[model samples]
Target chain A: MKIAFTTKGREWQSEMEPRFGRTDYILIYDEDKDTLIIFDNCEAKSHEHGAGPTVAKILIENGVNVLITGNGPGGNAIEVLKKSSIEVYSGAIEMSVKEAYDKYKNKKLPRF
Target chain B: MKIAIASGKGGTGKTTLSVNLASLLAQKNSVFLVDLDVEEPNAKLFLAGELLSEEPKYKMIPKWSEESCTFCQKCVEVCNYHALLGIANEILVFPNLCHSCYACSELCPTQSLPMFAQKMGTARHYVMPDMELIEGELDLGEEQAVSLISQTKTYVDKLLLKDTIAIYDCPPGTSCPVIEAVKDVDFVILVTEPTPFGLNDLKLAVETMRVLKKPFGVVVNRYDAQDDRVFAYCESENIEILAKIPNDKALAVLYSKGALIYHSSKSVKCELEKISCFLKSLTCKERA
Candidate 1:
């Protein structure tokens, strides 16, 4: 299944990619892809609101099934993802985005 | 009459002003200090107090039972918040996106949707040395903060009916929650510092108050910041400069340790007295 990780823009591009173990792929607005491409959201800018949501929307439109995040599933971004019927894991601030995806896949994460 | 101290931006000393001013007024009258900064309520720290109690409440959402749902898109069509969606198998409900409007339930095809409460968070009331501080804390995963703040207002109004001298320390942003807290107050003290960010945010906050038709004045904290933009904006708008607290590192240190400035500074005591008198005059005008 294609997956995307929703993150604060600052965390996306940091050199310290905070050990995400479950999901290997990241979502980014690649110039070559011309739309949001699932490569690594780490290619996106830091602390921006539009960049992450834009990428998430692109990923969802491109058939990404699951999206992982650090905070609870509330906010404008969550609203967008809910419309697409993408399953979101709300509690994952400590673990990496990939780890959260694994936990959700393994049924370790509770559905909100 | 209750006077709320608020800033458009965070970390601008709104809490410090409210705590000291409330403490100063509590000496003569029964003062009730309400910390409406639900995001990070820190007003109780300045006063020697413990949380009296807390109760969890919810932001109501329309729940649809799949058995009765006939795949009619009436609920989806009526939902302006886009909270309800009709998938192929069933109708989906997004709780976070819901604005608690029961239109979906009302417009349900088979009347399957019912409005139910979801736990939002708790509102804690604390009694301090000279004041009662009330705070409403939203749960970590909750999206509705305005509802919790409204609950705080309801309880404060019902309980503190005789409290003629109440000080409300409102949230930082000039958003829905701040508007909810300031709506019924008699007076608002717009606390801001003399910085670019301060001035910009002050403009937005003042615009909001003006739109609400609430009578308000400006309090320039950190008056020694060498920025005159706030003063210029206030003067142009004819907003009264009620008081100016200079850049005092001692007051900052006291605040860092959750202490009221009036406890340590003699000048703050005098400044607060002037503010109390100013509020009294404003209240008298409203009464007259």
Candidate 2:
């Protein structure tokens, strides 16, 4: 299973972004490979109207089964995620990537 | 000739200037007052007339046909707004983000993405005693305003005469909607107050007009003779101060009652006459 976390850095301890669409980086954790890969998502800054749809498309293309994010993906992003198999778990704002991942593993994170 | 009355900040009397000017000018000349502020068109509220016609406006959004799809991801790649997404066996189109540019639909190799009309707003035509009023009202939750404003302008253009003057009451701010509203106008009248926020937004509006290379000026609304920031800015920028509508409780009371202050308030009438002269000068320049 693959899981994604919106992060501020490439490290596991990097702070998770408080917003989903405009996150600076996206970190994917692969359970099968027991490895972590990071993708640059700084293009969200330049998006004027809708940033959620494209960003959600990235998570879908990367085969993310679960997502831990913050305040939004907005409505347009939510539309894309709704059609995918990715389960959304929010309320990860202000937490480190590792902490959010741990909370997800422990079933302490709220699922949306 | 077309003139758009715009303001960067809201509640600075764009509609007041538009309504009074249109009412006054329509007495001796043919005039069309179009409320391009689709999100909240209040120009119609101040003008009474029969609803000659009302029609729904549409925006061309893409409809994905799965039968003709090869999953080539061409639609997703061509969309500048990123409104389309291609996944395993399915393609998604987010209508909210779509700009209706037809780039994706036209570029699709298999005709998988076809343009479909989606209702975005309604355009109403009102015939006042001497002038005609046209306004576009955007549907609730509509994400963008440029398309509606453009469609309304096209509708108004068809009904305009060669000598008819067009006055557009534009939406506030210096954004895309405002840009589209003032795009083809011959002149722009930016209404602003004398406060810090008003001056700040006025500067942004001035920059937008400069970038568009349009002949424009400012009209100081609710003129506080004590404050000199707006006057100083206009003078320093070499911008003409077209008219000043003085601050008065009597004008405010009449405006609140949806009364045309052009006939009710003498001070406001004088300001409208000054704006009228400016419009006349523009016509003279065109003739010369």
For each candidate, the DockQ is: 0.07, 0.62
- Cα lDDT of model 1 by residue, B81-181, tens digit: 66665544566676766778799998776899999988887788888777788888888877667888888878788777654687888998888889988
Candidate 2: the clashing residue pairs are none
Candidate 2 local lDDT, B1-288, one digit each (tens): 999999999999999999999999987899999999999999888988999999999999989999999999988877778788786788888887899999988999999888999999999999999899999999999977999999999999998999999999999999999999999999999999999989999999999999999999999998977889999999999999999999888889989999988797788889889989988988999999
Clashes of 1: 2
Look at candidate 1 and tell me the lDDT of residue A74.
Answer: 32
lDDT of model 2 at position A23: 86
Candidate 1's displacement at residue B13, Å, is 1.1
lDDT of each: 0.73, 0.91
- Give the per-residue Cα lDDT of candidate 2 at A6: 88
Q: How far is candidate 1 from the true structure (C-alpha RMSD, Å)?
A: 8.0
Q: Each model's TM-score, in the order given?
A: 0.75, 0.93
